[model samples]
Target: MGFRNFRFQIVVRVLLLVATVFVFFKIGFNATLVSTQIFVGLLISGQTVALIVFMERTTNRLIKFLNTIKYDDFTEVFTSRGEGEKFDELYKSYNEVIKKFKDIRSEKEATTHYFQAVVQHIGIGILTFKKSGEVQLMNNAAKCLLQVPRLEQIEHLRAVSPQLVEQLLTLPAGQSAVLKLPHGKERVPVSLYAVDLVLRGEDFRLVSIQNIQRELEDKEMEAWQNLIRVLTHEIMNSVTPIASLAGSVAADVQDYLEAQPGTQICLEREETEDMGLALQTIEKRSQGLVRFVNDFRSLARVPTPKKQLFSVEEMLKQLQLLFQEEVAHENILFIVNCRPASLTVLADRELLEQVLINLVRNAIHALADQPNKTLQLEAFQDEDSRTVLQVSDNGTGISEEAQEQIFLPFYTTKPTGSGIGLSLSKQIMRLHKGSLSVSSELSKGTTFTLRF
Candidate 1:
């Protein structure tokens, strides 16, 4: 409608201008009406200029409105200029479209804020990063979990745990994995879940990290308790009777031998000797089996820790002294280091000592065949202000396969090992609200860390 009106105005101006020009030319040769002809010509030029200006004004307004929409500038208000009813309607339409755009933009902003709040307050750590490893978003939970104030790139996470950075980058969407991450002195097990995302045509990965250390410990402890209960019950029921019968048989055989001389019974000396030796063997084997069952019983019977603050320096010194003779006999170099000499840990000193002793003994055994044996006991505070005790050996390292099962009851690579030491030590650490972990490399050695 506006365009039609504009075209009609243009046609009227052209016709009026053409008529004035014709009038001016008809009187152009008459000297008596020269001034009148000049006035008519001037009127024709003014009409021509007005027509061009009118066309440009409408066209310029239309272009400006389009540009406003294109740049998302909803603040541009189209006002009526009193040109005509058609222009008034056009201006009103433009205002309504701008208002709608403003409403839509406001709604989008509110939605964004709502999601941002949820992401920030959620307990699970969330991290969103682009394909190039640039971190787009890291929620407060993620920052707290990683102990980083701010993370601009995923590579920065390598300082916390290199394995974690690798896992985050390579984890496939829709897949999940659980890994042990070293946080402070503690090894926290975290579960990772990844999702592929595309925002505005840019590829991204959304990974969620949740600490599952407590959950894992609970499940593991429950499994060990159940297994130990069943095994102890069944073994005790069978072994107790066998052990008692063996003792009774041995006593009966001795009495019978003493009474044989008075009852006129005679036997070959070799046969009598064989009978006595067999009875002794049965008694010894039965007793050993009973002791073995009792050892397994202890795994399920760990007591609650009676925690107290104790100096780490004194503790390491005591451990070193206790093993001084053995290390000397083995020609091993024993090193003890305690930073600050004043760091202390709140734990059951007795139980903590038991764990350290077990680790130290294992390290010693590992160094049995190494030409250059070294055993190190280190105590210090970790970056997160947690106390850490480490026992390391530079000797024959544990195999990768054995490292996985070293903390499981009855899982040992040593031929004569009772296999309860590592498992039992781990249980004690749990009672202290701490962790026991191991790291080893082939031919490099092993380190058992007790984190409190």
Candidate 2:
């Protein structure tokens, strides 16, 4: 209807102009009506100008509306200025279209921010980089794990760890690698997982970094604990009966020997003595087996820590005092150092002390063969602000192969080692929501770190 009205107005103006021109031409030859002809000519001229202006007005408004959209200037609001019903509708349509575009842009921005926030705050570290090693996005978790304020290129991580950079670059999609990177004085185990991404025809890689040191420790401890639980349960069940039977038999034999006075029981004195010795040996071996099983049982039965805040300085002091005699006898130097002298820890004091004692014992043993034996118990706060206690020794360090299995139940390097002490100590720390780790270099020294 608006189009029809526009066409009708255009046709009426054209017809009026044509009719006025024809009349002017007819009157052009009459000399006495020159003034009237002039006035008629002026009317025709005015109508022609008005028709052109009216047509161009709509065209100009259309151009202006297109420009507004082209430039994404949604702020422009088209309004009718007494231009008639057609332009009023036209202006309304332009305003509605602009409003829709504005809403779409606003929604797009909001969705973008929502996703950005989710990527930033997720616990796992996320990193997106191009095929050229240009880092595009790195989240807060990534920064914290890498110990970097910002990473612009993957190559920059070489300073942090060259192996990490290599793994990040060459790690295939759908696979993961656990990289042990040094963070301050501690070594952190990070699990890196990668997937290929293509955005806007550009290839990218999205890698997720997660500090799995604690998780790995927990899992390893769990596996050992489970194995020990099963073994100890089965061994105790089997060994308890044997031990009891051996003792009973030995007692019965002794009672018979004591009660009978030369009651000929098919035995010479030498034979009787041999039989008694055999029974005593059996009883002693069975009892020793029972004791060994009981020691391993402790690994599975680590009690929940009755935690309390205590001074680390005092704890180290107690350890030093406890081992004073042994250290002096072995001609070893025992050193205790706690920075600030007021560092404290929230833990079960007794349980923690037990762990310390085990580590210190191991350290002392490691230092035994060294000419200049030095045992040190150091306590301080780590970079992450967690309490750390280290027992170090300047002794014959543990072999690399042994270090890997040291925490496993029944894996001991020493000839007389029961191997339950380290395992039990690790379990105790786990119960307290802490970790026990060992680092050693053969012939250099050994350090056992307890992180809480």
Candidate 3:
């Protein structure tokens, strides 16, 4: 019952007990006094017991209400529906407050899950850190990009690179920079982004890392393709007329010799021979133009995947034979150390062979100026159960400026280099579900590693 109704009932009960006492007094003087006292004592006793029961029930209900929220049991909280109207209003307000907290907790959970998924699924690497340089989040890509094979290396780098340190110090609420990670004897590139994050009412700088190497490679490829198109057109313009003019001049020389065979001097024969040599030069350049066209066509042809299980060691051995002539002529010593003999990788044979040849060729070229020119080709199964091949040289290592563009088509250091070799090799590895990468230090050496 409501407070107003319960109060009315209690008032009626007290009045009835008082009336009884008055009636008893009317019967006899002394008896009336005793009867009135007894009635009052009974009324007080019963009311006291009722008060105790009400207090116990109220306390238990309050305890249950608090427990339901504390344990996150968010069902309806209403119990003992018929009670003081004020108490009912109080319970309703408690329920509303409890639901608000529940909603907030749920939203927080969903947001956490969403961000976690985003960081994991993104193609680029991501690393998050606080303003104090504590690691917050790191994705698989970030780990791979940084060559962070262990947690220890990751922790160590937080203290190693000054660029990363400065980013943490001067990082505004939101900002980012690129980091050059040292791996072996070389550095890898990483793009870092930082933002201010408020956790538990405190602001922290959240730094994120990404690998923009792929993006850069893509842009470089586009630029080179455009350049190739323009160069091919211009060179063809020059080459075509030169070829025609050379042929015309040689023919005219032949006609003059034929018309005056008896009158022609020994010096004239020498002149004719000179003309022949000039024509031969034009012919050689024309042939080179054809070869250039063929290489460009090969790059454009992306074959449909035809995967097969093949031994990487066997592939390298075969490449050794393929380039045997060139290596022998260059007096370049070749060594192939393929161990655990049969490392079967799933890839296209032709494409992979081409990639190995390209890498070997690149190594040979790098060794050109070295006093002790030698290449080491090593192939084996890695700890991760992947096939690994390494091509290295003891030549003057790649410079920092050249390292960035090494895989870009037509980015060559050699006077006669076309520069499409490494770029094509990278594409071949990608098509075969593998990776091609390098590590180098200037004045020391360079190493190219392919993992499948």
Error of 2 at 229 (Å): 11
Q: Which residue pairs clash in candidate 1?
A: none
Model 2 Cα lDDT, one tens digit per residue, 268-337: 6886787677677777767767777788667768888899999999989988999999999999989899
- Cα deviation in Å at residue 298, candidate 3? 2.8
Give each model a TM-score: 0.52, 0.50, 0.50
lDDT of 1 by residue, 1-452 (tens): 44356557777888888898888888877888888877888898899898889889989989998888899888898888757778889999988988988899899999999999999999999999999999989999888889999999999889898999999999888989889877788888899999999999999999999999889889999987967764675567557766776766677677777978675667678867776776776767676677767878888799999899989899889989999999999999999999979888899999999989988999999998899999999998999798999999997898888888788776677877877899999999988878999999989999999898
Off by over 4 Å in 3: 1-48, 57-61, 64-225, 233-267, 317-342, 380-386, 415-420
lDDT of 3: 0.73
Number of backbone collisions per candidate, in order?
0, 0, 1
**Which of the numbered candidates is closest to the native, going by highest TM-score?**
1
Worst 10 residues of 1 by lDDT: 1-10
Q: Which sections of candidate 1 miss by over 4 Å?
A: 1-266
- List the global CA lDDT of all models: 0.87, 0.87, 0.73
Q: Which segments of model 2 are wrong by more than 4 Å?
A: 1-270
**Candidate 1: what lDDT?**
0.87
